[model samples]
Target: MKRNYNKPTQGGDVRPKKALGQHFLTDESIAARIADTLSSYKGLPVMEVGPGMGVLTKYLIASGHDVKVAEIDGESIDYLRYNYPELAGRILDADFLRLDLAAIYPDGQKFCVIGNYPYNISSQIFFHVLDYRDQVVCCSGMLQREVAERFAAAPGTKARGILSVLLQAWYDVEYLFTVDENVFNPPPKVKSGVIRMVRNGVTDLGCDERLFKSVVKTAFGQRRKTIRNSIRGMFPAGVPLPDDPLLSLRPEQLSVAQFIELTNLVGSSR
Candidate 1:
């Protein structure tokens, strides 16, 4: 469903394209809440992804942090430039996933990431965040409620699966709050959820991090199967299994720590 816009755009108004998955957030309170999530990290470098119509972005700029906006939509970029003239040079006309983040900020810079993320690429965004775990101190965003819940879900629950295990291994995830379906420009079918993930103290997983990720993905690839059967390919030949109860349980039953322990055992065999 495509619709016209009537904001302060440089070239008049533009239509909200469905292909871009643009659902401009209209609630000021929700925008404030999303912005305030990064209040504790004051004066730090920050970037807001997909700042459509600058709903959440205005508050991010107002927070007085060195805020740069990564927006791919040319229409929205023009609107942001016209409405927020102060964010002139800071407006990055680039896709966030393709951005050279290190080139944007000073050397050795770590920053917070906040946005009303487009639902289509939300998971990809999280994976990109993981790639820079050392530099991204915090990520607060709005996304599909189901995905947010999955991030916050505990081990042994159905929601605890691939992303749940992988992200929890490093970041401490918190499902901050839930938002209703009526807040967007074109209301989505399902409700939205806001979640915050902060970089935890654990810099290392104490095992082969790559193997740990592989084990988690492989196990969850067949959630119903026991870890032994799921990760059969992890070892070319038969290897001694770890002396842990987790091996007998399905992938959903293992916590992040348990997965790490298993990864260490499996990695030793390989």
Candidate 2:
């Protein structure tokens, strides 16, 4: 089904909206390249977050994989439904962040997620994925270069932050390729990059997830401050000033394991 590119008489042209951070990707080559990255997982059901203009959707569907798309924009939904009639029922007109992904698959299997996400909520979307990491084997997305860098950054790097720690704990992140600003219909001011995150097996951290998150957040809250000072409140009975490497180092210097160790230490003392 081919979409009507011209604006409909009932609704005005839904050009890229700054509020929604909608930058429609018009470059076919880039779309194909993004689809190519998913070639290995041909039989898996793929959940695409924002299928703007059906460029990437077309490629995914053609690649012999079952494609389910979640598009928030009404105009894009109309366009997609009109253009790809076969994808009508498959396309979910709802926010990806709120949807229960595991329910979307028939066999109760996880789907590989892909999208050129809205920049405004990219971080939130990632957090959503992390919450349901068990249902996702792999994720590929187009994000602002800075955001992509954070996913693939090393523990001690400038790009490493709360996002890095959270993502790296569960996934092996890779920065694949960079995309220029000119590729979109209404080009964004900044460049974007493609990132792939493959889920690692369940970690054996042996600590409460909530406590681990709290400890990491506290440590990174005042990144420049020493761990001893930053996480003082996390331990009600007072955290022992450990002779470990973490006590002398700043938050950015500590890996996820080190942070988990700190949480375990705090939990043990309580």
Candidate 3:
């Protein structure tokens, strides 16, 4: 059986905007696969970010999940509304970053997030997802391959950074597959990769969550510096640093558990 998607009516193509990072996925199979990646949590609503021209949106709709989309591009919004009428009032004309995520769903209603994310703001989007981690049960999408690797990177690898530590602390990250540039309109200079993140069972990090974030950000803010040097400012003056051997390692060398341990250590000193 063939899955058919709506195309722009003759002469009505939505022009890809460089400033908006609009590289629409043109392959049907890839779109379906990306949509299907939300397997862990189902029977909940889905909010798609930057669904330019509704390529991936079509499959989400077909999969029988209630779908809403947030798109900042005026032309893409217009195209989606005109082409995908099933969305009706669910199309949002606002930027995904500024939207109040808590208000999108009813009180305690968890939803999955999927998209062919705009490369420029992809990291920002994941941060937003982290902020709403309790409500966003699953997040899966396409992004620049390097960025995807960073999300799925392990502790000892160079790709592991602030994103890897923070996101992996709460979500199980998977690097699904790689995509070629030829599959998208206005081909990107680099290949793309898709990843899925499912919220883990951790309701709390067992330390000050706020301080945990600060520690992670501060440590990786200067990746070259050893953890001891990078996070020295987090401790108050005159407080002696702990003699833990982990402090001698670089930020990329510590796992999420090590970061939590460090956070608890910092909290104890202060």
Candidate 4:
């Protein structure tokens, strides 16, 4: 079966904007796959970030879940509103990063997030996802493969850095598949990857979550240095790093649990 999505109609020319990192996805099967990945999240209010032109939105609406979209590009927003009149009040014409995530739903509403994220700001999107983990049950999206690998990379690998430890601490990250460049309208130079993140059982980090994030960022910010030397600045003046086995390893070598333990140790030192 085939579907027509965002096909330029009689007199319109909607092009991808380079400044926005908009390489519009042009493949139907991939769009369906991305939409189908959220089946387990049925009944949850769905928020699709950067819905370029309603390609995935069609399937999302057909899924019978309440769907809303946030798009920064006015042209795309105009295209969507003109084409899909059903979404009149559902579209948000604003940057996803700047939105107050807590206000996206009703009280106690847990939702799912999906998107073909802009390459440049994809990392920033994940951090926001982390910020609202309590309400985001699942997140599925497409982004640069290298970034996706960093999301799922494990300890002891070169890709295991800050994002790896921080996101994995509360979500089970899965790198679903790789998407070649040719499938998109303006094909990106690098291959794209699709990933799904399901909220894990762990709610709290058991330590200062802020401190854990600080320790991870501080250590990985200077990746070549060992934990002991890299994290010296995080400790208060005259306070030494608490004795810990992980202090001898580099940031890329420590697991999420180890990072939490290291954060607790740093807290105890002061």
Task: Give the whole-model CA lDDT for all candidates, comma-separated.
Answer: 0.85, 0.83, 0.90, 0.88
For model 4, residues 66-179, the per-residue Cα lDDT tens digits are: 899999877787778778777989999899999887887768589999999999999999999888899999999899999999999989998887898889998999999999
Shift in Å, residue 31, candidate 1: 0.6
Q: In candidate 1, where is summed lDDT lowest over 10 consecutive residues?
A: 3-12
State the displacement of the C-alpha of residue 234, model 1, in Å, after optimal TM-score superposition: 1.6
lDDT of 3 by residue, 214-260 (tens): 99999999999999999999889998898999899999999888999
Q: What does the lDDT read for residue 252 in candidate 2?
A: 85
Superior candidate under lDDT, 1 versus 3: 3
lDDT by residue (67-131, candidate 2, tens digit) is: 98998777788777767776968989899999987677645587799999888899998999887
Stretches of candidate 3 exceeding 4 Å from the true structure: 1-12
The residue ranges of model 4 lying beyond 4 angstroms of the native Cα positions read 1-12, 236-243
> Number of clashing residue pairs in every model?
0, 1, 0, 0
Best by lDDT: 3
Better of 1 and 4 by TM-score: 1
Candidate 2 ranges beyond 4 A from true positions: 1-14, 237-239
| C-alpha root-mean-square deviation, each candidate | 3.5, 3.4, 4.6, 4.4
